[model samples]
Target: MSKRLSVETSSAAASSLFQQCTPFGMSIISAGFQRSAQLLEMSSLHPEKTREQILEQADQEWIPGTVFLVDVDRSLAVQHEGQSDIVLIPQPSKDPNDPLRWSQTKKNIQFAILFYWSFMTSVATNWNGPVWGIWVEIFETSYSVLNDTSAVCWCFLGLGCLFLQPTAMTLGRRCVYLFATLIQTLGNVMGGVAKNVGVLYGVNIMTGFAGAPCDSLVQISTTDIFFQHERATRISLLTFALYSGSYLGPIAAGYIVENNRFGWRWCYWFLVIFFGALLALQVVFMEDSTFVGQRENETEVEKEIIAQVISKEEGQVYVSASSEKDQNVTVFEEKDFAAPLDIPTQRTYMQRMGLIERKYNDKRPWWKIFIRPSLTLALPAIVWGGFVYGVQVMWLSLIATTQSEFFSVAPYNFSTAAVGDTNFSSLIGCFIGMFWGGPLSDKFVAWKARRNNGVMEPEFRLWFLILPAIINSGGLLMYGLGVNAGVHWILPAGFGMGCLGFGMGSGGAIVLTYALDCYPQLQSEGMVMILFLRNMIGMGFTFAIQPWLDTDGMVTTTWLMFMLSVVFNMSCLIFIMWGKKWRKMTKNLYLKFSDPHFFL
Candidate 1:
């Protein structure tokens, strides 16, 4: 077999000699092509796969840059009739220098570092919610000023959420993680020793920015490490970190605050030490998670097979490369084959690192991230979930203020510390909620998806939403009534603690899962939006909460809250029923369509 081919301008060749290449070479190319076609089909018919299958597939396939391709622009990128060219570029080796395929041990360590970073960030944001009274006393300020401080802290949380995507896109996930962790730790320490409210607010801003990367980086990292089906469970676990930190924070704060000698300062000091240690751990564990290349162990035939599978699944038009270069390749090989032109020139280690940094440089502004439908939908969920989660977080204050006057007098005669103890029930509720939300959500979504003819609809994710809505409303109402009648304090405490936490967690899961299902492509953007909305909602609720309770009393205010909750819960059902329609209609407007053209 003899053929002539240009190195760079090579075109697709259909000659018989080309098809009769060496057995080893042909086998590798064929495998890669088949794999690509399968991947494309899977991505295209998503939600078609059941939950178990999805997760199973993810566990099996989710390697870094597992579905990536290289552009061979000069050639006709196509497939013959009845032959699906799944593989985009058979043996399209990524620069081995790419960081995407770092050792598993290294990746796990980085993930752990990110997890701790998030834990500290969330802790710093809400840890102060429980100790507002202490702040009022220490600063010798009016309650209004204390309220402002609280609002300020939450607003910063909001700000962090809002900026997360833009920052990640602009600064790159690694830079954001590295700097944000350092800044947040420093902020916590600074806030711990600060005497003035002004200084405290400044430190709060620092902490807020510092915390931004926790969610953003974790999201990016999750994408890096896991495939689509595994995303929810892994993201769910990441959220578990947040909830655990949030729940433990107040417990730790209450105990520390109970010690008269330690007071609130110790709470800040405690957070500082915890986060500082976390910062140190992250420095070693976390690394850049980007699309680096695979090793040669991944054979050429395997690459082509995978790429072919991906192409069909994605419904992309596949055009075959021209035969001009194919002819040249045969002749060249018969004489003395040159190095495969597809293999890129290797870079020095420093040069490769520099290239990565250059890619990390800021490209898009922050607001650009929110313009897409995937981001738009996901952001709301994040915000709402965050809002609900935050409200539950400060449930202690809401309960204390609303029920305190009633509990302090007459039969109860409870001290401040005892009031805090009432919160133990809510903590238990949170645990129940967290445990139930995880597996139930995974199972329910899978089952419903099967019932719906194997198409995974976003509505399926809303099944759990119903439980939380009813529970949260009923719990709030019970707490109000218990306080109104001055019944045994246990009534309000148990209802608020147990039911409230359960409801919040259920709602959180639905919102998160839905957002993810709807906007897998723009997940980072979606997460950022959700984070922003949630923190802002929390801040608003916290500020208005005291006033609402003061004006309407616990019973009336709680009833009103119940009504509001009912409306949103019911809306979930409506959305679920018509969600696909809504999503389709809004796909261009407010919904982010998973790139039908995307390769897994």
Candidate 2:
């Protein structure tokens, strides 16, 4: 009778354990329990061991959730020789197939591909701006109309993502990337052959629509593959590539249009060729990083072990069945402790290419994907990020739209090639920011973590914004004053542009990294919010700047821009001080709106 009572208690405990383990509502618990019961039976021979002792033993084992064997206090620390202090947040899984577990070589390759794609797409977006001067004559359109074409394209760039990002979530990112590239390439071809300004306008809109992913998707992909500690650095690199392409495109276009042989149309042709190459590279290299489902099936014993480990880590005591009646039940399975470094070959190349490994079952209305991101604009951090980037975009548009006129008719009398060459200063600044921004922010976070007993918060990254804000404001003032005073053109073109690029690049990195760090679950949507505000603000500025300049003159307009920059840049202080409080306030809202399956 006593034996029967013990067995009944054991069965009840096992049933309860199975229920807790199967959160996804899988019915495989019975099968798993059968395997677990067999192991428990063997353990029944070891009656002397207490439940506490068993759990203590399990805690010491190198289980998934257990304190890592390398360091108990710093479980997330990597085993590198010099960088042992650097802890990887959102600790990488032991699974070989995990993207975070991928080799550094593979990660670098992926980064390169993403970087190149971002650079090329940005080049495509702005290449038309510098060549607009020549298109005025060829297309028989006024400068305002041609400028409007570029502004429309900028707006479409943001609007396209509303639809495309949802498709990326439903269909795989790789598929969306391929499709967008194809559309962009075709659009470029059409633009190259366009006979009239209307055709050019339509093609520009098409290209902008297709190229939208370049702004947001690449950053999302970076987050997908990299750990929290690595994201800021990778994002900084991506920002550099993006800004490089933006600054370089106009330079190349200016010269391309100036060349009598190739002329303005070749600008679009160049994009066609570039995107065609990019499309091919993406097909061969980019793989779907989206999680379909768990691919590994652990036996019941393994499941029990994992459960015990998780419970131990969470400070929950797990009383085994044997513990109820002083039975010696010790279940021990030989653990595979080796870390699998090589990529698994479970899926065939055809399956990878087809993206058919696991079909995503996103039941949300398709339009919700489009609508949800726009709703994120209400979030303070998201809005702040958008505002900071939008101001920068306004400045960028001001330069791109007005530079040709500024240089052509001024005391400088810069040739098209010289105008193009002037972008080198901006490029240099971007490089500086790319190198300086990410690592410094990362180090700041790490240092702060060290000071805070290893508790790292997202707000640590925002401290770096102060310098960038001041530098950007100063640069705008210098450029405006230099241009108005007709100080040697180099003063405005080189020093001013360089400083502006550095500030914009660094500022962009800070805000983006902060947003991603704060709400990683909503990264894609948050990015969309930033993109929408950025482009819309840019379009507004592009439309208003010419008229504003006519009325207020260059110095007043530029000083106004500088004041606006100061306001936006200085807003980072509010985030740094109260960002945490804001995040806490909006936590329920984010949980309510965010897709649970995202980053699965």
Candidate 3:
């Protein structure tokens, strides 16, 4: 009977172990356990294993930006890198405070505030376009001299992005948002009372410096609060903010200047008032979205081994086992280890409103982070993406600078308000572009992914660019040729301008989505290079538009712009075919940047 009881006990132990490992899709966890076992067996739980080392091992085979977006077969339940049943990219951590896990209402509220700032600040910045002719008369300056003010602003806009983003990364995003608002408000106040072109120059400088975050921080915040699939739409909204404000600001400024009561100076005063209101809203609602996760001190293997030991023995525990020594020993832990992770207490409302979140303690030096953006230019794909959007910005600058100069004294002889009204068509086109660039692109890519066994490539974004490229390049030809022929204002302003607006809105979305999807490591830095190249090209064209118009005549210049736009915009075809090969070539560099601690 005793012998029979021994046999039954052994059988029971074997069944319990088998049952423990039988949960559905538990094989994924077991694979990780195998890695954890190998980790221990290699060095008997080396205490000095750094977070970077662990991450490098975990990230062995995966390429940057190549992700399994959808599960084609029902049998597939978990992604190797992420635990989500639905395969959400940038998988949400269990921490309740992670922005990814925030409630939809909370996420929407925060994003709405960011979108508002992007729109209104752009409005304040570009109000000068409609008033350029009026400024020429009042300040006794040439149109080129007036355009120089914008040229200065564009230069500073790039510089501001480089300098301010590091601070935003280090101090917290909200601090920079508040600081920029204060500076812009000051600039607008000066613009209202300015007596000369020099004062206007100063106004542009300050405002441009303040507006840098519009490109860099706004994109970072978008990525922080949204998932991979969701980001294209939200980023497109940011592009819309830029287009609408560029077009609408001049419209608002035109009417304000045309009013008998307000006059041209009131454009700045109106911005000052609006900016004051924006500052208040931002303070109340634009919560800092920065979150850098901390690595656990203990490994999964450590947790499993320790849980079998006494809870009292865990004051400071170290497990040292070696095949050479033929013994396993668990001793005092040198570092305190918390029990398995549970959702930490959620922050109170006041805590969330604090200027900086307590958890954002990235130990990398601020200067290193500042220089990182510059290093990204070495990536060939990044450089190519910059040229694509840089050309689009070149067109935008042309529209803003040329419209007042062209129509203000043409056969059409448009008044200031009428010049502003041209932008209404641009605005309408932007609305359509937003829908095409954002939701439609997302759904289409998703459908394509389903067809491709549920694997989505970053290059998938470039496929839709074909439509935008043709429309945009054609729009340039129409606007230029129409102006050269001095046709009715309706054709160039309505159809041509509308087509340009569509390109700006849709093109911005596609290029931005593609670049970030290709290299999401430190997204702010990745975007900085693109915008830097964009602003530099924009600044160059801002200075060149008039000279070119004078030197080559309207017809020749128009043809030249059409061709330049065609070459840059249509290059998406080349990328569409070979982008995956390029990505594979850069995979090592991408992996280096993706590591949070790689620089350190």
Candidate 4:
């Protein structure tokens, strides 16, 4: 009779706490505790189960972190008529202002615009790769000196993000996007008319800095508008645009350089014309997506409520709704409340351009932006992400540096157009990867979650890395060995280059998606870190590759690169086996360093 009374008292306390906190907060707290308890018991019973396996089980039982898991099996809120009831992780608010609540058509339109913007900028940045041979002769400079121009540009690409990210977050993405496009367009015009190598080098630095956002900002925008399940596929699409533009640039530049009527200068002229057109479209169509004020207030309220409930000194006796017999604790179903669809007052055309100034809380030190991204480099995941992206940049640089030089001389005397056309092999591979990588990753995670009883963990996505790893490693070896042996150019150019693109497309997508999944709140800063590392490493390789090739020859250099690729690609295993423990260990650190007001 006394024990029964104690149980009743505990249940009453839990009911009171539940009533105080929002359903989202309650679900997070309850799921975390329940999952922790299950892991403890499972570990004791089955010591052989890896932490990843245990975490997968925990995810099956409850959603990770503060994300509210939806019940797809029962929820009636369908995305479309034919679609099944897919669970929405980080359950969408009924608020019409919520990005998740936006009509699918609106989201798709935004994505298309962003995709085109990303593609154009990437094409402009890399068109110089295939034209390096022409530039060396025209500018009366050595190969090494001209290469430094590309290296400087790549380095600036990384450094530019240090300034761009904070400004975008504080002001608005639209403002930054327009400013970057305008500057890049002007820089291209300057580059096209430059008379000397020094002028061209300066222009490269200016344009490179302006173009940095093309790669980093798109990922942030995707996260701003899309859900977790949608991120992988969306990121894949962006990656496709990025690489396609990059490869296609070389093709176009090659033909342009080969033409007597339009030479190397015309390449820059083409970018000037294209970017000028792109800027006009951007000013007309783009809108600021940052939801700072409302999101910040909602986060504070949620935190205060959570604090009140968790501050109680009572023992761990609270009964969760999930504990009830035959009852599944679905946060979204707790109260079938729908907020009024409040339509925002439409803005004027100029207002839509986001040129109007808005006040922000600027008390936070601006230097934190620069400092925090550097600190994130200490994370194993960040370092790994850097390696995954950086290595691909390095390999591409190797090809860019060597391709024109080798093909224009000796055994197969290919014309400038032929040299440029060879990039088509890589373009095809990127297309394959673009299609295969994203959707497959999303599907893989969903399938794994279902198998684990409807709980999903980020590590489940890493399994797809294996096939790409093998393809990338094999391609590196093939390219190196074939080049050294003086085999048919197609062997290295066609098969080897194609494989590299395939691997880069797929592997790069996975690493980026993983980073976002690990720290959604700090995504802007996280991407800054990724860009910093990726470009810094890329710049270093750009500077080093020509000298290394000179010293080491094709066989030794390629073999060294191959070895590095294998080692780095294989490190995914470490994350798969112990990634959960690392996440748990860093949770407090992440919370401490990350902005508190940016809840999903």
Maximum-TM-score candidate: 3
Note the residue pairs that clash in candidate 3.
316-332, 316-333, 317-333
Q: What is residue 440's positional error in candidate 3, in angstroms?
A: 0.5
TM agreement with the true structure for every prediction: 0.67, 0.78, 0.82, 0.80
Q: Once superposed on the true structure, which residue ranges of model 2 sit more than 4 Å away at CA?
A: 1-72, 75-85, 93-95, 292-345, 355-357, 360-365, 595-600
Clashing pairs in 2: 43-329, 43-330, 46-328, 47-328
Estimate, for each residue in 1-600, the C-alpha lDDT of model 3 and write its tens digit: 999999999999967776787575478667888998897886675444443434344345345566666645422322222332234556454455667666677788899888989998788777677788888888999989977888889888888998888888787888899999999999999988999999988998999989989977898888887877888899899999988999999998889888999898888888888899999998888788877654221122222222212221333332322112211111112122122356465666788778765576455788887888877876767888888988988888898898898888868788998889889988888888898889999888888778876667888888888888888887887788898788877778889989999998999888889888887664677888888888889899999988989899988998899888888988998889888778778877866776656667
For candidate 2, write residues 67-94 as lDDT tens digits: 1212225332133112354444344434
Model 3 regions lying over 4 Å from their true place: 1-61, 74-86, 294-342, 597-600
| Model 4, span 1-600: residue lDDT tens | 999999999999998988899989999989999999999997787555333443344333321232222233532222221233345443444434455555577678888988998888888777776777777887888778877888888888998888887777666778888888998888888988888889878887888899888768888878777777788899999988888887888889988987889988899888988888888887777766665434332222223222322322222122322222222212222124344448343334465465633532223445655566765665667677877888777777776767787777777678888888878888888878876679988888878776765446677888888888889888898788887787898888899989988988888888898877776656777788887888888889988888988999888988899999988887888888887677667765665557533221
lDDT winner: 3
User: Regarding TM-score, does 1 or 2 come out ahead?
Assistant: 2
Per-model RMSD to reference: 14.2, 13.5, 11.4, 11.5
Taking the tens digit of each residue's C-alpha lDDT, what string does model 1 give over 1-600?
Answer: 134555323445534545778999888888988999998987787534443443344333322122222222222232211122122212222333333333445556666776666666767765654565556567776555555565666677667656665555555566666677677767877887889777777776787666766545576666665433444565656665665566566556767878878877888788777866765655544555554224222222323333433444545433212212231110111113234568444334454333134442434444455353233543334344445444444443354333334454577776545544665676677666765566667667556644543335556667777787788778887787777787877777777556876766556655665665554445565666666666666667768877887799877888887786677565677766766555454444332233322221
Error of 3 at 138 (Å): 1.0
TM-score for candidate 4: 0.80
How do these models rank on TM-score, best leading?
A: 3, 4, 2, 1
Give the worst 10-residue stretch by lDDT in candidate 2: 325-334
